[model samples]
Target chain A: MAPLLEARSLCKAFGAVTAADNISVAVAEREVVGIIGANGAGKTTFVNMVTGYLKPDTGSISYQGRDITRLGPRATARTGICRSFQIPQTFARFTVLDNMLVALNVARKRDLFFWRPAHDAELDAVAQGLLAGLGISGHRDQIAGTLPQGVRKILDIAMAMVSAPKVILLDEPTSGISTDEKHAAMDTVMNALGERGVTILFVEHDMEIVERYAGRVIAFYDGRILADGAPAQVLSDADVRRYVVGGELHRRQPRKGVA
Target chain B: MSVLTDRNVLVLLAAIPLLIAAGPIMPDWVRFFLQVSLASGLAVLGVVVQMRAGLVSFGQGLYYCLGAYAAGMTGHFVGVTDVFALLGLGIVVAAGVAVVLGFLMSRYREIFFAMLSLALSMILYGLLVKAEVLGSTDGFNLPKATFLGLAPTEQALRFAVYALTCAVTLLAAIFLYRYLKSPMGRIGEAIAQNEIRVEYLGSSARTVVHITYVLAAALSGAGGALAALANGHVDPEMANWTTSGQFVFVALLSGTGNVAAPLIGNFLLEMIRVYAVAWSPYTWQLILGATMLLVILFLPGGLWSLVERRKAGG
Candidate 1:
């Protein structure tokens, strides 16, 4: 079968700076992938291009065997590709459960135009079930703005998941989370997502998370993929180590032959 | 207790009968004040509807004026004084304009949207001021409105108009509440909160704004028609910037807390205007400005927040 989502020779630029250059990626069904990169390395640009938040300067993207490169974010989401943000985006004034309900309510376009309340009991049940699965049901009544960082992160992912998209791009799933809660948050998210058999691509700076949860890892440097393989292999690749994982030039081991 | 909640549908529905029952004992001025208030409230309600989607227009008077003229023209040219027909024509005309303008309006946000709306209303004002046949700036008197074929006499006319206004206002409030509770309506608030998130949820923010624009225009149209009928006259002033500003002021004062808020806010505002103008006359606007300032500073949520605070506190 064709890959769940495929981007071909994608290139995007802002003024003289290249956000994504000659980038191509394929996400297969049911695969859990982790992307590692430094700031401004084009990880988010890749996700943005795929989810149709930003159009690629040159390239084609296909989903489920149909061309989706020209689609907008709303159209792409309807085609089963959704994305969550680095900073959680939610309706701050609404209750946490209401946030989920918004996702659920907007997902069903046919039943949306009626005089009946948007807070239908059926959708309410589904929202509650989703919240419970993410271990955030206890905060359902709390205003989303006041939610703890970990809970808000889960809520963000949960919103992207509510549509049951076949592929989800999560930008820094554990970015704002406390160090102690990182694994727990990942465990809860991965386990909940696993039950639904979702294919997830998450960006993270934490090496341990990439090694532990990712079935495949792709390392990005500048605007290109530096390494793509199993976590152990890619994380140890000399170029990935030097350009991505290794923070500074002083931290790198000089090449023996060249020296 | 949830004053901002749509659950107040029943309370809104109940208010109709309660007001109708009280109409008999009311003085002529009170009845006149209420009908005018109810009509203006509908126009302000239009403003609030758009506010839900994080959109505001300084040109809402464009539709209000259009509604009145559309209805006014029907009587002037078509000789149709049946109230329902006039109101229906008003809605159709306003909605038609909104449909075309909404496409353009939907593309804009914040200040651009406000200025564009103001510009459109002023265009109408200028046209109305110049058109000689439509009575120019002086405007023209409307024929007495009749229900179906039955025309109420002078003695019963006040109550008749008052009752009609109540029924029409109630229906508008209820339908608007339902829209607010609907998914599309909720989408407006979501769009207000985060337009990007709304798009990722698989709905168009532009479409929501367009629908809301049309919906608001229709309500303002109905209000203008009813007001024209009640006042027995229509004027270019209906589309003035000050008039549109008044609608915005009433919308902010009412808060988006409940469907009933606009009507209550308009009524209270009319009462305040009556007292202020009676006492201060030339400085009445200063008094209204101070009132609005106080509302902004202390009751930022509008008058409805008082109800919300009491419920939250209790």
Candidate 2:
């Protein structure tokens, strides 16, 4: 079967600086593809281009066999492509469940008429289930901004998951999360997506996360793909070693007893 | 409980009749106060829309004037004194203007948006002041409005008009509260927080903001038309930048939380103006300025947020 999402030679630039340079990748259905890069390796830019937040100067993005490169974010989302921001950018003044309800409305393509109570029992149930899956059912009524960082991260993923998209892009899902919560959060995200058969394309700086969760890894350096293969192969590659993986591999080697 | 409920809105809707019935029992000045409060309250609702979406539009007066002028002109030349028809024309004119101006206004941000709005309203003010047919600077006086077909004279008619204003303001307020509670409402809040993030989430911030601008303009237009009907006059000063500033003042005093905030703010301001001017008309502006400064400094989120805090604590 054709890949669920295909990016062909995508390139983006800002003034003289190139953000994404001649990059191409594909994500298969039900696959977890990890993008590993340094601070400004254009990981987020690549995701933005795919999700239609930013248009590429060159390249076509096809989702489910249709070209969606030029579609705006809402159009792309309507086509079952959604993204979660690096930080949990939620409706701070609203309740957690209300946030999910908004996502559910978008996913179901319902006109937003709050006076007319939502009649989609299935959507409500699904949102509750996702919240429960993320272990945030206890705080369903809490204001999203007041939640702990770990819970907020989970809520962000949960909101994205509400759309039931074919592919979901997570930008640095565990960036500010505490070390103790990172693994659990990642596990919940991956497991929930896996259970729903949703494809995931996530960017991460942590090589251990890439190794543990990613079925495939793409390493980016200086706005270009440095390596693309299994995590072990990409991590062991000499060029990746010199560029993206040098410090990360060295730090993890001792902990994994592989020095 | 959700304030967006139809039943809740209907219950509020029922209060309009009660207020209308009680209007005859109140003194003439009290009835006049209610009419002014309703007019200002509607304009403040327009302010709430802009402020809630992180926009500050100083051109609301442009639409307000558009409504007033549309109603005045239609009544003068078209001979349509039917209140509903005049209101419809006012809203249509305002929405049309908003569509044209919003295309340009939606592209600008922050202070530029506010400045552009002010410029647009000032341009309208200049035109109205220059046009002798539009009553030049003195403004046009509207004849008695015939409600549906009933023509009552002077005091009885003014009371009837005040009742109509109350009904329209309450309906508009309830509709706005419902609009903000919908899916678009959530998207609006997201846009206010982070436009880029909203776009990344597969939503168009521009489209959302533009729609909001047009809706706000339409509301302001309705308010302006009603004010003209209630006061029986239309003037260039209605479109002045000072009028826009007044709406902003009301919005800031109310915050954007509840539908009742603007009504409360308008009432308080009008009441203060009445009493302050009674004591010394020359010091009224100074008193208003000082009171606004205190409100901004002490309650930045406006009075609605204060009410919310109180409710949460209690």
Candidate 3:
């Protein structure tokens, strides 16, 4: 079967820096993949290019077997490819439920012109259900800006999920979350997506998370994919260990009981 | 509780009859000033619409002048004095201008957007000042507006225009209330908050901004046409920078959260300006400035916040 999303020979550079260079990736439907890389290693660039936030210098991106390389972020999102930001991007002054409602409106392609209200019983019920599923219903009425970072992160993900995209690129889903709360945040997010049978490619620096949640791993180094395979195989690859995961392995190895 | 909130319909319905009745008991000057306030309020409401999308259009007077000029020209050139026809033509003309300019204006944001709008309005002001055929700076008077086919006497005309203004203003408020509650309107607020997130939600921020710019221009144009009809004059001053600034001031004075805020704020501002000029004509500007400062400091959400707070509390 064709992959849910595919990138072919993607290359992008910023002046002297190559943000993504000759990197290719495919995300299959219902697959949970983790991407690991150091800062400036092109992990984000790859995701950006795929989600149409940034255009690649060369190569093509296809979603559901259709070319989407030139599409803008909005167009790409409409094609069932959505993304959450590294920093939570939400309507800060609005309540959490309002944010979800806006997402649902765009997702459903509702009529925006004329006298229809933004809220209804059906929309409220759906928003509340999504919030409850993510364990953040308590914060639904609160202003999104005032929520704790972990809750904000979860809310951002939940807003993206409201569209039920075929593939979602989450940029550091647990970055701002407290270390203790990181795993719980991921558990809520992964379980929610899993229940929907949605494919996800999430970037993370936390090796433990990659090991625990990711069935497939893609290690990036110097704008190239160093290794791509099952978590155990890719984590032990010599080049990945030397270039990307070297120092962090010793600290995280004991937690995962990996040799 | 309908798809569009209808709670404010009763308030709107009540305001119309009360305003219509006030025309007889109110002094002539008071009634006249109220008509002007309602007309100007429509323009301020336009500014508020753009503000919801995080845009501050410093050139909204362009449309205001366009509306007035359009109405004025219809009476002077086309010799059509029917108030509704004049207003309709004005709206169509302003919307046409917006369609062309919105394409360019929508690409900008922040200071660039504000300045570009200002530049466009100033351009119109300069052109109006130079156009000898259009009465230039001195401007020409408008013929007494007719209602359908009846041309009332001067006293009756004032009451006619006043009643019409009240009806139009009430209808605009109701229409705007529905729009503010609409999904499109909420998305505009979302654009103001986080445009990037709006894109990821599968809606183009630029498209939303463009639509808002055109909608606002239409409203401003209609307001300008009404003002022209009420004042019985059309002048280049209608499109001046100071006029645009006043519209902005009114938008700030009234929070964008509620559709009626700008209308109420504009009326209050007119009353305050009248009293200030009467009480201390030389320092009226100082009084206006002071009031603005106090409102900003104490009511960051403008006068509407008071209403919101009361509703929340009660």
Candidate 4:
């Protein structure tokens, strides 16, 4: 089958630092792929380039057999490639339900300028249902900014799911979440995306999350892919063990049973 | 049917008779003050819309003055005395200008947007002062405004203009209310919060801002035409940065609490300024400045927060 997304020989440099260096990867349909790397390992750089947030100095990106290398974030999103930020991006002052409703409008491709009242019985019902599914309906009327950090991240994921995109890119889905709460958060995100059969390429720092959720794992080291395979194989790769996963894996592995 | 059922439309309907009745009984100066207040309130309404999207157009007076000049010039030269024609032309001219300027303005945000807007309004101010036929700095009177085909006597004309001002402002309010409640309006709030996220949600911040700019300009234009009719004059000072700043001031005074807030805020501001100038002519600005300071310190959401707080409490 044709890859859902493909990037070839992606290279990017920011002044003195190399962010993505001759990197290439492809994601299959409905594949739950976890990408791991140390800071500045070019995981985000690659994601940015693919999402049209940053232009890669060299290479091409294609989605579903069409070239999308130069499409901007808005156009890329319209093409069924959606993303959520590392830090939850939300309309902080708007009600949680309002956030979902706006996303729904975009997803449905409704004429945004339609002059009727924004909320009708049917749309509100759908929005409420979506929020309930994300376990955030109780806070429907609350401003998103005031929501707890973990809930905010979940809300961001909820917004991303509104479009039911062909592929979703999540940057650090559990970054600011507490260690105790990360598993629950990831569980909610994974289950929601899984139910929709979304192809996901998420950048994660947690090895356990990468192992437990990812069907395939791609490990990055200093702007290059060090290993790409099943989680156990890549996590145990000699170079990955030496440079990336080493002692941190040993310390966190014992706690893996919680998920 | 939906337009008729809208709450804003209902409010406008209810207000028309009350305003018309009040016009006849109110003292002449009081009637004049109300007319100017309602007209200026419409301009502030434009500011309020841009504010909701997290944009501050310090050059809104550019459109306001353009609307006035458009109306005045057309009435003076074309012999178009029909107030409706002039008002419609003003909106078209202003919106046309906005379509061009919004391309540049929408590309900016925060202080850059504010400064660029201010610069544009000032450029209009400079040009208007230099244009001799348009009355230059001294400005010119608008030919007597006529409604439909009948030119009412002076006292009757005051009431007509006052009634017209109320009706047009209310209509603008109703449309603006719908715009504020539309999906695009919600996206405006989202753009204010996070532009990147708005893009990821499949909307362009620039596109939303552009539409909003044009809408705001059209509104300011309408307000300017109404004001020109009410005051019987159009001056270069109408586009001056100070006039634009006052619109911003009214926006701050109104808050983004709701669409009606700016309109009410404009009325209260005009009332206060009138009283201040009468009671303490030389130091009236000092009083106005102090009141603004107090509102910023004590009621950051502007005067509308009082109503919002009451609703929340209830």
| CA lDDT of each prediction against the hidden true structure | 0.88, 0.84, 0.90, 0.88
TM-score of 1: 0.95
Error of 2 at B147 (Å): 2.3
Q: After superposition, how far is residue A257 of candidate 1 from its true place, in Å?
A: 27
lDDT tens digits, residue span B220-312, model 1:
998898888888899999999999999998888879888788899999999998999999999998998898899999999999889889999
Candidate 2 vs 3: which has more DockQ? 3
For candidate 2, the TM-score of chain A alone relative to the native chain A: 0.94
Question: Compared with the true structure, what per-residue lDDT tens digits does model 3 show for residues B1-314?
Answer: 66233568878878999999989999988888889989888888889989988999888999999999999999988899998899999899999999999999999998999999999999999999999998899888898789899998888887888898888878887887788778898998899898998988999788888888988998899899999999999999988999999999889888888888898898888889899999998999999889989999999999999999999999
In candidate 3, how many Å is residue A230 off?
A: 1.3
Per-residue error for B310 in candidate 3, Å, reads 3.6
Pairs with backbone N, CA or C atoms under 3 Å apart (clashes), candidate 1:
none
On the 0 to 100 scale, the lDDT of residue B36 in model 1 is: 92
Clashes of each: 0, 3, 0, 0
Misplaced by over 4 Å in model 4 are A253-259, B1-9
- Quality of candidate 1 docking, DockQ: 0.58
RMSD each, Å: 3.5, 2.6, 2.2, 2.5
TM-score of each: 0.95, 0.93, 0.96, 0.96
Docking class of 4: medium
Real contacts recovered, all predictions: 0.77, 0.50, 0.87, 0.72
Question: Residue B255's C-alpha lDDT in candidate 1?
Answer: 90
The residue pairs that clash in candidate 4, if any, are: none
| Tens digits of per-residue lDDT for model 1, A87-185 | 999989889988888899877773248476788778989999999998999999999999998899899999999999888888999998998999999
